[model samples]
Target: MFDLDRWLEIFQTINKNKLRTLLAGFTVTLGILIFTVLFGMGNGLKNTFYTFFQDDAQNTIFIYPGFATKPFKGFKENRRIEFKNEDLALLEEKFGDRIEFTTARISKGTTVKYKSEYGNYTVRAVHPEHQYLEKTIIDRGRFINENDIEKDTRVATIGRLVEKDLFGNENAVGKYFTLNKIVYRVVGVFSDEGGDREERNIYTPVSTTQLIYKNTDKIDQINLSYDMAIGANGARRLSRDIKKVLKDKHNIAPSDRNGIYVESVIEDLEQNLQLANVLQIIVFWIGLGTLFAGVIGISNIMVYIVKERTKELGIRKALGAKPSTVIGMILQETMVITMIFGYIGLLIGNFVLNSMGNKLEDWFITNPNVSQGTIIFATVILILSGLIAGYIPARRAARVKPIVALRDE
Candidate 1:
């Protein structure tokens, strides 16, 4: 099906109108470049949302205590709704099957000292199961154990940044660090891939912290993990039930909206899913629009070329050239220009995105990339563009007759 003569004719025609060819090629390349990068940006935005999900389990829910904004049962407004250590235990007992892991947390910024090197870092008192709630990467030794809580032993697991600040190049594990002047043995050094900012926290057993920091039986928040079988709908129902249970226990009104602050990771994940879907649809439409613009430009150029070469086309027809031959020449030229330039644009966009890697503009954009499937899609669009641009003009070329060509000035 390959015709060398048709290809030669296309090349000769394009060479004679270099500027015209360049303009047509520019339209195709520019459209493809914009479309490709839009795809990359949409991917980057999805990654930005994923970074938050990485901080905890996909099914984790966080419960932070807040004051009652409305009163109930002879109580006035603005009553404080604080969580006690007993509240978390009671919830676990009541919803053991629905919940997989649960932990109470109390955190504050305090001075930590190791051999005269001191820094202010956020110290968190958490149960042993707290490790499962956060993306805790234990770099050395172990996290707080049940033994630490049972005996109320003073033990610490410091973040990587805290370790670097307090004991650089020296092993922190098996050593002692004083927090608020109370010496606690360092059991582990941990970090988050979210970088040094998230790695500045130090964790200890909740029981020990209550004794040392005078938190007593009070807990600031509760972290919970659940099975995926209790999906987003189940999770929402559980969240509402938990809030109602706590409100009733605290004697807050049934309608008191500010009695507690309960958040579900399931809800956040669902919202993210919706946002990503919308972004994909918008990118698809915009890319199609740009591609159409390129097709229009190529179609316009082909029509002008057919008009300009009417005399030549007529002479070829008079000399017994077939109609298919005339159509083949025009189609070959359009396809050559579109395919070559569109591929170049795709390659350049991929190069720019690949060069960016993990770090890019702000934390908003990370690892922007186009998949092989998306590239295949763009190629299919190019082939259609070639067909559309050449069709009408090639048909007109085929219809040219010797008398009409002799008449055309």
Candidate 2:
């Protein structure tokens, strides 16, 4: 078991054709490297998608009106459809319990001013629930409340970036800001989210918006959240129910299909996650296939090595070397080459992943490392590949006859 001489002889043979051995090892290394990198990328892409959806409730739905794609009754194609406050009120009455939170929004991009300092940005009129729907958090003061909506208060919540630009470090709560010369009180300051356009917005009550913007009883869009207990299927059913109510109220056909749009956030997220899972599987298989091919190449190279060293093996056998000794030498050489290079590939892949993970995380992608199970599986594959590659050649070497091998050049 501790045959120093046998190990020395194995190294001497491998040293004889160092370049060939190295080339074979390199193929395996390159294959494993590609496998590791591609797996990391797949994980990154999945995390990116999840991050994009994180800011919004996974079960939320958005309703917006667009031109009719299909002509219905006497209505012509491409006719514009508008949503009104009455439509939202009717939906709330019909599906009150099915809804978690509901709000309507109307946005205008205009300049906001306080004294001499002016910052131009978007202003939104939203119901109290808009804060929860959009995942808006207050840095100071409070968001729009039911009291503001009920009384049509001229109170506004500003984003952190807007606060810094208009007020600097000065307290903005209870101060006043004017949008389009319509005075509104600043009741809150919100934090920013890097590239979020919403972070620069100022939010006010939907009722206040309609009154100030002369949009009485009109809304551009409706945002709502459904109970998480009402899963994707239930959400889809509720969306259809809402669509039917809108079509009936608007005097549009149920089959008109284009007069209004109702979207389920849960449905979109579920579909996207499914697609991501498929792509990840494809990535894993491609990586494993490449690694397997490299392992096969190593097996072929070992076979060739056994063939080339037949005479040397034959001389050893004639000098009382056992078949087990010959086998042990070949197996050791194969394992050493495989484990060393395979480990190197693993280390390099992990280093690359760590370096890119942070930049990817800022974009909302999560831990991009291969799963522990996957790593363990790959290690097992590596060990088995080495054993198989070595075993076949060792079996052939043990079969060689002293008389025949001695005659070989």
Candidate 3:
């Protein structure tokens, strides 16, 4: 039960010691505030990592050709490496089981005109599989099909911003657009998570670009998605094997680094995620440290409060108060102060985080927030700290003799 008289006396004691009570509450409030903010910021940092990687498929890999730095077989040093349609077919044939999809990329910059509107935009000549590799979402129509690639059709898929820039609010699908004075029909209108830059580019059949740009089979890059079932270590091995195969085919020395570059998205993502996890762990420990400091502060303050009330506690015990009752009274007072101040800290911390919004995006912190489970856990800790802080001093006071306490100054 509720002990109205006992609570009244507790309030009177607190009323007489305003400074002491405020000090104890301030310690708890400050601790929880710092803890909440630090933990939320850690979560924000993690969000940044995910957001950055989400623009591309996590299991994807990119291959780029570079000038060979070492001579091998009949090939001389400083030979420029180039990937072609044949390379894409070779990977599909050699590593078909490990590869999910592959595409050859040929990038060019051209002025696009739609009626009276025109803009300078990038053009990506790619196979049908490039849609998946680039995570292109077809909004108004279908992406490039096998039929388009087979006939080297002059059909194009335009990005969201491309439609907006050159076609205004008009739907781009089934419309005609000119790239470098060559007309191509827009078969699809698409969007990308890669922001405005990606959404400003146009995609066309790799065969059409190869024929129109240079009348050759040259490609600038190769992109592929590896089977996710391969796991991280397997992905690394696959990348190494790919480099070896391509190097051998191109007659480049095995030790030459400039001949080929293979980038595994999963490998970089794993490393970055590990780093984020470590950072969260560090923030957790720091939050716990702050709570620990608050506990110690409250403990010291409880000891002082008990010392000041030594004579009063002795009188209550002389009047036949039980040890548990004395302990409960001190505990009730401690809990009231801790509960009020700790909750205030939680509210203020959450308010600060909410107000931050995207202001911290420049620092790579996005939507920092603490889960309800964390809040509940912290609340429990706060209550227990109060109990522990009160219990030790209350027990010591209850044990002191009435005569001994009354004689003290």
Instruction: Judging by TM-score against the true structure, name the best candidate.
Output: 1
Judged by whole-model lDDT over C-alpha atoms, candidate 3 comes out at 0.90
By summed lDDT, the worst window of 10 consecutive residues in model 2 runs over: 190-199
Instruction: Please rank every candidate by lDDT, starting with the best.
Output: 3, 1, 2
Off by over 4 Å in 2: 1-21, 73-76, 192-195, 315-329, 358-367
- Model 3 misplaced regions, further than 4 Å: 1-19, 70-78, 320-328
Give the root-mean-square deviation of each candidate in angstroms: 2.1, 3.1, 2.7
TM-score, per-candidate, Cα-based: 0.93, 0.88, 0.90
lDDT of 1 by residue, 237-319 (tens): 88988888888788888777788888988688779968986987799789779978988998898899889989888888889
How many residue-pair clashes does candidate 1 contain?
A: 0
Candidate 3, TM-score vs. the true structure? 0.90
* Candidate 3 structure quality by residue, lDDT tens digits, 180-232: 99999999999999888899989999989888876899999999999999998
Q: By summed lDDT, which 10 consecutive residues of candidate 3 come out lowest?
A: 1-10
Give the per-residue lDDT digits (tens) of candidate 2, residues 360-390: 6765556677777777777778878888878
The all-Cα superposition gives candidate 1 an RMSD in Å to the true structure of 2.1
Cα lDDT, all candidates:
0.87, 0.84, 0.90
Between candidates 1 and 2, the one scoring higher on lDDT is: 1
